[model samples]
Target: MFFVDTVEVPGLGNRSYLAGGRTAAVVIDPPRDIDRVIAAAAQRGVRISHVVETHVHNDYVSGGHELARITGAAYVVPAAAPVSYERLAVTDGDVLPVDAGIALRAVATPGHTPHHTAYVLEEGGEAVAVFTGGSLLIGTVGRPDLVEPRLTAALARAQHASAHRLAAELPDRTAVLPTHGFGSLCAAGAVPTDASGEPTTIGEQAAVNEALVKDVDTFVADLLAGLDDIPAYYAHMGPLNSGGATPVDLTPPAVADADEIAARLAAGEWVVDLRSRVAFAAGHVAGSYNIEAGEGPGGQLALLLAWLIPWGKPVTLLAESPEQLAKAQRELVRVGIDRPAAAATGTPEEWVRDGERPATLARAVFADLVELPASAILLDVRRATERASAGYVEGSRHIPLHELRSRIREIPLGVPVWVHCAGGLRASLAASLLASAGHEVVAIDDSFDNAPFVNTPAADRC
Candidate 1:
């Protein structure tokens, strides 16, 4: 009998798969940290026979090459993916046997990337499951714009065709396993769960996926309309994945004392506090940005820090414990932020220098906005798409959270800056950023849905 197992990287909103007969298996689209994949194989009593990548991913670095090297397995890549590594370059219709009756068949499904491919797994000469990767996600498809601005329109059309092709060719019961759309920015639109809380099959996809239901023209238009800003860090990911990205080093980073922390902060380096938003607001070393690293499945540390921080700047991670620091390291590596220049663990009391008090902020809800003086400047740091759809206070100035650091100069100084996002997490991060920049700040730690002006003229919006 054969079984398929998932290795989920919740932080990145992606899944790697291990599937095989009792004695052997193949790993599909693994994350940079391969230890989880190895442990998963060990638990199932299977020796890995192959490591495969569906595309040169733009969301995270691939662990395929390193996983294959460690297991002495054949690494498989799409025929058109340009890479320096030696691999079995698969074309459409090539079948890779996985011992006994299980095997993987390649199908060209390029849209997420120019060379993207999907793999169909068959048992006893019948298709059972297909790894759709970014091409065909849960309810939406991978955004085609990540590759190049010029190629976006064409790729959107291609994505529509690819989704239809898979639905047409596969049986109703064929399981559809995708790599994105589970809260990953790679998705072209919002993802919707089925009655089972998953878009589990080709039949389910046909019933709801826009690419399957709409004509190619309508699908492309709808997709382009819903596209969000690409994460700034995504530009580095494709090349890292395709150009032989080195395996990550997970050893604890060098410990930073208060002196080194102060030095780094003085030199304009990033000193990120990885504690919870609540704890971080109560107290933290002066000038440190709070990202709250251990947000689990819903965390945005990898996306936010990589997008907002000045690229390639040295970073020092500070957390409440050694374990949290290590977990944050793992999350960073998945997105190709390979190393933390230094790290520190302990409370704000331990992080701050002698004769200095820990920095603190006021965490307020939307109700508190009415109490602020008219001179208070409301800063909405949500994505443009969110502001357009969800509405915002009329006079608030806009700066996306990703662009806030670089655009800090544009925001007027010496004013009470009340910052907000769709939800509070980003606002907390933005609040810390504005505070670090010497502005008096308050984080609106409440949902936008709860805003008093949501339906009034104050929030009448696109």
Candidate 2:
């Protein structure tokens, strides 16, 4: 009777679990790190009965679908899930029989994202534990603003209602095993951890979680007050979870010759140099994007580089060999930038001699101080959720990146357009988009939680 809690940390995205008796196991809220889950099941010598998701996650790409493909297990999600979930969608009071004397029950616990649920495991007539995904964290509940538009009022009402429902329903003794723990962003307040910083209990959470204040109204109000900045990539995450678009895991077929690579570069293919910073600086293609494969699973900085590079342009991957390319692809897919083209033939020296063109673009941080004073217009290319989470830079026009294409005419092209996202990815993408439309533009990396904001060249920032 061993229950395994699979902790996929750091570069992996989110945590998950493999729980059950000897005959079968159930997985919850899987991230892209499917290998770990597979290995755990192998070690335990149990077939995974089903992959369960507590809610549609926005923090990282959900690996439940991919895991289901690998394990041949049932992919069970909530029926209230916004999109087509390709598997058995369970509703409240629904009991999924796993094996002899074991069953999983889905209890509707919305607020995180409308259809959120907490799965309770009943083994041999005793409720074992509840798999609280993002709904209830170590010391906090799920944020309602992830789906609900209004941050303050709307999210408050939703989260408050959801928490009260969970608190009132679940039995006190049910062991609570949640998807995210101490370090997860799902918890708004400081995560409650054990002495050595591990996931605490639900009983502990009920006692001290600030969001669960005295009454429903105050709890919701407090939730609305401290919402964090919703990542720019979140808007695309939910749809992908519900089977909107399949990720193209583009790994180059095989390593090619330097001359052939050089030819491709000369033909105007963008280079994505997946190498170490030292190696890149020593010698690399003139116009290649530097993203090292050694940075570990999902190099966040590397992913940020991918986001900043001009979208819609042909990308040529530059890695030492096919093995490196495979690793780079893993990193790229972790962040949703799938199927990057293989690197073209040739070393940096060869490409230089061939007179391949350098990728050119003007970059700036697009702060209102500079643009407003100079009579240039400042455009906010961040999402509504982002604006609600992290307040927009004062006086900046709000035109989210997704709507930028259609809303371009609203901005005067004659004046220099300054653009920015919550951090910098969307800003870079926005700047490139504006540049393609013939607007003189600059993208800036603002909202850095550290260091006094400084101005420098794009090369330095990149």
Question: Judged by lDDT, which candidate is best?
Answer: 1
**lDDT of all predictions:** 0.88, 0.64
Give stretches of model 2 more than 4 Å off: 7-9, 32-36, 148-152, 168-176, 180-197, 213-219, 244-270, 278-283, 292-298, 301-314, 320-324, 344-462
- Model 2 clash pairs? 250-339, 258-345, 258-346, 260-345, 261-344, 261-345, 262-345, 364-443, 364-444, 365-444
The digit string of per-residue lDDT tens for model 1 on 1-462 reads 778888777667788899999889999999999999999999999999989899999888898888899899999999899898899999999999997999999999988988999999999979899999999998789999998899999999889988989999999999998877667888887774221244389998889888998988888998999899998889898888878779889999999988899999999999999998888889999899988786345588988988887779999999888899989999999888889999999988877789888989988898887897798988899998888777777678899998888899887888899999988889999999999889999999888887766533344534
Would you give me the overall lDDT of model 2?
Answer: 0.64
RMSD to truth, every model:
2.1, 7.6
Please provide TM-scores, in order, for all candidate models, with all chains considered together.
0.96, 0.67
Screening candidate 1 with a backbone cut-off below 3 angstroms (N, C-alpha, C), the clashing residue pairs are none
